[model samples]
Target: MKKLLLLVGGSAGLGEALYSHYKNLDYDIVEFSRSGQQPEHVFLDMSRKETAIDTIDLQFAQLAKQPWQEIVLIINAAQIGPIGELAMSEPKQWWQNIEVNLTLPISIMGRFQTHFQAVEAPKNIAFVSSGAATSVIEGWSLYSATKAGVEHFIRVVAQEQSSKSNPITPVILNPGIMDTQMQATIRSSSEAQFSNVDWFKQAHETGQLASPATVAGNIAAVLSGKLEAGQVYDVSG
Candidate 1:
C-alpha cells in the first residue's frame, strides 16, 4: 500500500530527521518550508497565512487524486523569537510568531480535514509542540503562549474528531530540548534576553541534549504505537 507523508518545516532539525526517516521507508514525501536543501521541499511561508493556505489547498487538490493507503500531516514549523522580555519585544515580531506557531497549524489542519474528509485511508495529524507550553520560562512569553495555544487547539480538534465516523488521529508532541538550530538560538541569547541561556549552554556542553534524529525516531514510534489522540507525547520519556 502506498503511503504519503505531508510535512511542514521538514527542511532542518527534527523535521529534516522525520523526512529522512519516512523517505527511507519508501513513503511518498512532500515537505513544505520556506527554504530547504532537499528537492522535495515546497516553498510555503507559514508567516503569510493566506498565501500559505492557498499553497496547501493547491497541493491537497493534486494529492486527492492519488490513491494512498495512509496519509500523515506533521506540522513542525514554529518560531521561537522575540526572546527578550515581553514588554521590550516588538509587537510585530510577536504577531508573526503567533501566526507561524499557532495560526498556520490550525489552518493547515482545517484544510487537511476538509480536503480529505471522504478519503478512506487512515489519516494522522501531529503537531510539534514544546514543553514550554506548560512551563513558565522567563523571556519566552510569546513562544510559550503560542505553544500553549497549539496544545489546547489539538485537544479541541481531537474532541471534534471523536464524533466523526472516520476521524483523523491528532497527536500533540513535546519534543524536549534537542541539539537543533532552535537550541542554538536559545544558547546564543544573552542572559538579559534569555535567563535560561546558561542552562541551555550547559546542556550542550555536558551533552545533555538529545539529537534531532533520536527524537524523530521516538515520534515515529509513538505514531505507530497505540497512541491516544490528543495526549502529549514527550519524546524524552
Candidate 2:
C-alpha cells in the first residue's frame, strides 16, 4: 500500500502548497480545510473541538477503509492576531490564539495517536512550527509562545513513542518567514507600530521571502527520510 501524507491546513498558504505538490505524487494526498470548497479534502475548523474531532474522525474512518501504508500529520493550521503586550492584549483573542495554535494540534494528535499506532507500518508526524518558537519577537508573544509549546509537545510525543517502542517519528519544523497572507496581516498591523514593515513588504514584493512550494518540497524530502527525526530544520536558512 502507498503511504498517505495528510496535510491539515489546505485552504491557504503552506498547506495549500504542500497539497499541490503531493497531489500528483504516487502517494495519496488528503487535505483538511475550514471551508468545504475542497470537497475532496476534509473540512475542519480547528478552533472548535467538536468540528475538528468530527472531521478528523471522518477522515480516519475513510482511511481505515483504504489500504494505507502510513500516516503523516502536518499541523500547519494557525492564526495571527493583533500585536500587543500580553497585559494589554484582549483576553478573548489570546484564548483564541492558544486554542488554534497550541491546543488544537495537541488534541488532533491525541485523537489520532492510537489510529496511527494500530497500523502495522511506519508513521511520521510533523508540526509546522515557526522561527518564533526559538526567538522572541517583541509583539508576537501569543504566536511565539504557542509555536514553542508545539515544538516542546512534539519532542515529548516523540519521547513517549520511543519509550513505547512505537515506530512513529515526530518532528517539529520551522518553515521560517514566508510571503503569505499571515505576513501581510503582520505588515498591515505593523504599519503604525513597526518601522520594519516597509522592509517586510519589499521582501514580499521582491520574492525575498521563501516560497511555500519550496517549504513543501523540503517537507516532502523529510517525509522521504532525507531528513533525520527529532531535529528541527529551518526552511529559510
Candidate 3:
C-alpha cells in the first residue's frame, strides 16, 4: 500500500515545499490549497466553516477507499496582519487570526480523527505551530494566543489517544523562524510598529533566513518517523 501524504495549505511557503518534495516520492501525494496548481490538489479555504468541512469530507471519502498506509496533515495556513496593541487593533482582525490559526487546525484534526479511527493504519498529525506560541512579543497577542491554543489542543488530543484502542500520534511542532511570506507580510504591515522589520529584510537579503525547502525537509523527516512522536521539534538550523 502506498503511503498517503495529505498536505493542507499547499499554496504557501512550507506547505509548498512539502508538496514539491512529496510529489516526487514513491508514495501518493495529495494536497489542498486556496490556489493549488498541482494535480490531485483541491481548492480549500480553511477560514469558512462549511467550505472547510465539505472539502475535508470529500478528501476523507477518497482516502478511505484507497490502500493508504499513513495520513499526514500539515496545517500551515496563517495570516500575518498589521501589529498593534490589542486595545488598538481591530476586533475583526483578531477574530480572523483566531479563525485561521486556532479554529482551522481544530477542525482539521477533528476530521482526521473521525476518518482515521476506522482505518487500521498508523495515522499521524503534525501541526505547524509557531515560536510565538511560547515567546511573548509585543503586538503579537492574537498570533501568540492562537498558536498556544493549537499546541495545547494537540497535546490534550495526544494524551487522550494514548489510552485509546486505536491511537493516532499527534505532534505539535514549532518550526521556528523562516524567511516565508508570512514574515514578509508582517514586515510589510505597519513597519513602524514592528521595529525589527528592516533587520528581517536584511537577513533575507543576505540569505541568513532559512529557506522553505529546508524547513520542509525537516518536516518530512519527522513524518518519516525519524523524529519522536508527540514531541515538539523546533526546525531551526
Which candidate's lDDT is highest?
A: 1
Strongest candidate by TM-score: 1
- List pairs with backbone clashes in candidate 2: none
Score each candidate by Cα lDDT.
0.89, 0.77, 0.78
Candidate 3, residue 87: the lDDT equals 74
lDDT tens readout by residue for model 1, 1-237: 799999999989999999999888888999999987787889999999999999999998899788999898999999899898978777888889999998999999999998887788889899999888999999998899988998898899899998998888899988898999999999889999998799899999999999889988998888878768899988852
Q: Candidates' TM-scores? A: 0.97, 0.90, 0.92
Instruction: Give the per-residue lDDT digits (tens) of candidate 2, residues 49-119.
Output: 67788778777766756667666778788887757566756788788898889888887787667566667
How high a TM-score does candidate 2 get?
0.90
lDDT of 1 at 169: 86
- Give the Cα error of residue 168 in candidate 3, in Å: 0.6
Q: Flag the better candidate by TM-score, 1 or 3.
A: 1
**In candidate 3, what are the lDDT values of residues 1-237, reduced to their tens digit?**
778887878886888888888876765877877898888788888667678888888788778777677767777777655476767677887777778888887988898888777777778888888887898877777888888998888888888888878788888777777878887776675655665667767777887778888888888877777534567887654
Residue 157 local lDDT, model 2 = 78
| Segments of candidate 1 deviating more than 4 angstroms | none
- Candidate 1: the clashing residue pairs are none
- Predicted candidate 3, C-alpha RMSD: 1.8
